[model samples]
Target: MTETQRPLLEVQGLCKQFPGVRALHQVNFDVIPGEVLALVGENGAGKSTLMKILAGVQPPDEGQILIDGQPVSLANVNQAMDQGIALIHQELNLAGNLSVAANIYLGREPKRFGLIDSRAIRSASAQHLQAVGLQVSPDTLVGDLSIGRQQMVEIAKALSIDTRILIMDEPTSSLSQGEVERLFDVVRSLRDRGVSIIYISHRLAEIEELADRVAVLRDGENAGLLEKDQITHDAMVSRMVGRDVSRFYQRTSTPPTIDSDATPILKVTDLVVPDHPQHKVSFEIHAGEIVGMAGLVGAGRTELLRCLFGVTPPVDGDIQIDGTYTPIHHPIDAIKAGLGLVPEDRKEQGLVIDFAVEPNVSLASLKAHAWLGIWIDRQREQVEAAEGIKDLRIKTPSADQIVRYLSGGNQQKVVLSKWLVMNPKLLLLDEPTRGIDIGAKEEIYRLMESLAESGMAILFVSSEMEEVISLSDRVLVMHEGHLTGQVSGGDINEASIMNLATGIQAVS
Candidate 1:
């Protein structure tokens, strides 16, 4: 930042305290106009508290906020909005049953003849929507739109309010690759128009690509600040964790092949989901092997995992467990056949957020705690839940704490814990480490390594190229619902994976 150019927004000596936690500790930060400022840290590092204070959702215990070098008090969301500050939450805030136009101008509808001017609302909303590259009719229901399009509507809403500084929290956490690109385009365009943005995310690659400056927080304190040229991965990691993370993804140096005498835990022959009958997929995961599935967004990696787990039955296929043919027409059958699956969306598919941690940990193994097939064995349930909590190192005040109160990483661990209680011979993991920080990712990686060492077969799917290359013993690449090729050891690189994923290379 140059001397004459004052910051668009600045917070000095910010502090926040919860019941037993100091969320933020006299943190200081600033953002220049028309620049992308990335705020990064591990979970519970006070990023959310600072954001809430800035957005007027909560008050800081000690701080002064300045806009254009003038101090201002953000008493509430309305007051913050009056100062041209708007926050877009990770979980979108929108009335899905209402029309797009109604949602945009919800409380501040233009008046016409002492009544809501519906026609004017639609016309104004269309212009704002166009600004965000959304061309749909304003009268359409928000519920009918995809998640990506709904995000565009959110940006449109902010634009309609004449927002000068935008705070986006994990905006791309649930978006696909194409949708992320579209969102990035809109963000860059907004920056070009002199709109400042505070972007918070766990994805380091996004920070490297979009941030002009990076501010990292650790343990409720300001760790360090990096300008555009200094924001490298190692620098960010070193500051965030107070140590060098040079070997974050360190792997075992074992050979990819399993022992010749060992049996295959999972084997599939001519597997075909109903949506992709044209492709004949076959693979085998042997004991103690970590096999990764790599592909593009629509390459049917999840679909294949679903078929294998009996969430979606294969149209024509043969599944074998320990060299014996098995029929898995339902998830219960798969569970009985010694298989467990951790789905992609942990919140929606893998966990019941309303339930407590203890109950969620033992949900999948409830049958194991049945008393004479009538009553649940409470003592057994508690014992198992405690064991899972200890083994996973889940950060919770108590086992009775609601799962919803945990961080994203802890919630994912709860999901995995439920499956781990089953003692399945084969485990299927879909996007295991999505939306988690480096520390949590490393913990999960260590858990996977320990599991593999215990003679379990792990088949995981990851969209991240680096994760696949580092974690997989052998990787299976898919393209347009077909198994394109397989790579192991020295052949596992970005070029090889992309070529197979795009259908430029076939299995040979």
Candidate 2:
């Protein structure tokens, strides 16, 4: 509010550089003691780099960090933590093999008589978890818990520390609506108690709900900061991309016109995964149609997609392509059958970060670039990669640029390009636009529309209700692993989807 109420955390002249790129450029930002300051930008805009510098994961090439108005140098993570700075990265870093309590109080476990006090640690962890409104047992294994619970554990771990500043990077990306509400409550309580939070999220709605001030970054520089009242979604989008972006989910009004009696490209009858036996899913995707899968988190939307892609074997189901039933036992089998899956977790499941963009896009179609004696044709590979990069509008220095260096949206495009190279008859896209900026999201939506227009059968899965309603010709809603209802045309709005997803109506 005033200089007298100076921010508890001040960053000035922050600069970071990699081999061929300047990741961050003289970035300056501040966070008040009792307010949520949102750090937002497009992928590779240096948001993560700046946060990493603050967390001591990376040292800034040139910068001054003032904590409580006193200059401090953080050489490593321990030093950062000792200075009361805690960072929760986008990727969960918990020890899956350990108990939640163990993971929470990992290095700073309570000791009694020169021995680890397991009971004390568990009790403290439980209390911190409860403070965050998470109802998970301390003894539960981290891997055994859902992604949402694992995220809660991460937050609880941060709270267990004597943290003056908490940095959360996309904290609610994987959370359901209910879980997000609980997280917001915890964040509010923490803010009232004088904890400075640097909230980073792509969801503009969440920023409006949680952030007191918003700092925008673009192309490794500070664009500007907006007060809560002045920040609108449109303004934020423009700031992030340096241009005004229109409606992100722009779908055509033309109805899908697949031949009514045309043979089904993909037919799944009584699909049931072992983990989800209750879901007796049956669906048919016609060639040249984009079929939308709409539902809430844990509504078996992703699970169904996985089953269709053979990520997991379905216990009782028959998959037929072009009127011929085929048994798919693994992803390889599915791919051979002209089916491609763009998994939900693009970073983990879709792309190999350490590899270059060319390799990633060509990974699934290596055979196409192979020569005599199983030797890879480097020239052919480059040609294919270049085509994909241009077609997908992937922003990279070149196809040789590592995917790890690309932005989130670019990485997603690479994943899509990878599958597109396979020339699949059926393409399964799960939450394709998650964590991407509005401009990039619109580009992806356009690509999907174009692909469907090209006579490719696409099964689109998205958590955004508006996306589902606008993009899909037919919407199938699932609840607790069961296909509860299907809506076509105008009936695919939020209310109808919610009603079906919550089991308020029967499938027709």
Candidate 3:
């Protein structure tokens, strides 16, 4: 914000264009030494494109990058690093087979007598490792370290390259609460030592806690900029979405009711998973209701869903649908019993990236397309796939286009389409919008509302607190493999959720 002095990093008139998208247009920003500039925007808002350009992952169509008041060309990642700029991706780029010291000095190991100097590497690695507050030995295997520790090693690797500016993209998305706190300490220490940082994340709370200036982008343009004092949840949301977000999560329908005559569509009684048999959990979701399961990272929320979907069979439990006990011992059994589960990792569990859109849509319901109990009915498959594409508003070149070619949002829609055709009585979503754009998130929320209105029972698990609190009609809080409490109406705030998730009795 101190503009009288020349900024350490400056971007001017940046533009990036894809085949069908103008990713960025005349975008400009600057960061002073030791300042944390938070780049925020909805998905598809050009944030990633700009970051990629800065990191030399790709060339910008038009732009000027100034480092220390001198124009420079970041022709490649190495060139950027030579200019004292380093990028730490969300997915750590450490080699699991290598040792910590080897990873830190992978390509640039010191040489002695025409051989790699092991002592020199360990000694230097120790200094950088201590700079990031990591206490692990330099010889520790990178794979054996925890995710949080791996992230620290990444920072040490960057510092080893004489980095003056650091760009972190979603650094803490996979970290636990304790890990996040430790990471924040490292960021603060680095900032104090005069390393300018450009932090990009969807979590506004992180930006508020760490950033000195907030830059917001919308639809590939500069929406607004906020100084430290001006950054608030409402301000950021409004600028990111290009509208007032007072009612962003407002419900369209009234709260669902369950009277004495109404039978629950999805019921779990005394469920016990193999991992934690001592904790007995129970919950019931009625037709036309959307129930949200809220908990911390290890609070058994996803485990419960896995048990319900038969991904991990329950050790002991009674699952009933429409007042009849239904035994689900495997994924196929759950599918046959009119249940659909969208796993947390879409790329890993929910999708086959090598397949085409039409085939992916019909993957879960192939039984309906089977002919004579042997051959597939291609024509019928295409018809249903086309119908699903139209209903889901999936943007693709054609049904034959590979699903891997689609955007993250479109890929998720394809995953949903696969199960939607089966007309499952109960739908379970685990982190449905995990890595998608904000626009896609809003679309998914609307879709969930529509499905619940049409009498489908919906239960979803989310790590994001705001999402669970705003989207659910009722929230079930879990703690350490147990159902801690239920929150509804006036008791759905973060305080209450965190209280119940940490094993404290909720006041409500």
Best by lDDT: 1
Worst 10 residues of 1 by lDDT: 247-256
* Candidate ranking (lDDT, best to worst): 1, 3, 2
- For model 1 the local lDDT of residue 324 reads 92
Model 1: lDDT equals 0.89
Higher lDDT: candidate 1 or 3? Answer: 1
lDDT of 1 by residue, 1-508 (tens): 5854679999999998765557799899998989999999887678888898899999989989999989999989999999899999888999999999999999999998999999999999999999999989999999998888999999999998899999999898778788999999999999999999999998888999999999999988999999999988888888887887754497864644677777699989998887789999998989888999999877899999898889999999899999999998999889999999999988888999999888898888888668886788788888877888899998777788788667778888989889898989999999999877788788888888889888888999998888899998899999999999899878988899989988977556
lDDT score, candidate 3, position 319: 95
Residue 103 shift from truth in candidate 1, angstroms: 4.9
TM-score of each: 0.88, 0.96, 0.87
- Candidate 3: C-alpha RMSD to true structure equals 3.3
498: Cα error in model 3, Å:
2.4
Per-candidate clashes come to: 0, 0, 0
Ordered list by TM-score, greatest first: 2, 1, 3
What are the lDDT figures for the candidates, one per model? Answer: 0.89, 0.87, 0.87
Worst 10 residues of 2 by lDDT: 247-256
Which sections of candidate 2 miss by over 4 Å? Answer: 1-4, 135-137, 506-508
lDDT of 3 by residue, 1-508 (tens): 3454569999999998775557899999888889899999876678778887888898999989999889999989988999889899877899999999999999999999999999999999999999999999999999999888999999999999998999998898778899999999999999999998999888778888999999998878999999999988788988888777663466788667779688899889999987789988888999988999988877888888889999999999899988889998899889988899998878779999989899999899787668876788789889988997898888776798777656677889999999998989999999888867566788888899999999998999988887898889899999989898899887778998888999986564
Q: Tell me the alpha-carbon RMSD of every candidate.
A: 3.1, 1.8, 3.3
Winner on lDDT (1 vs 2): 1
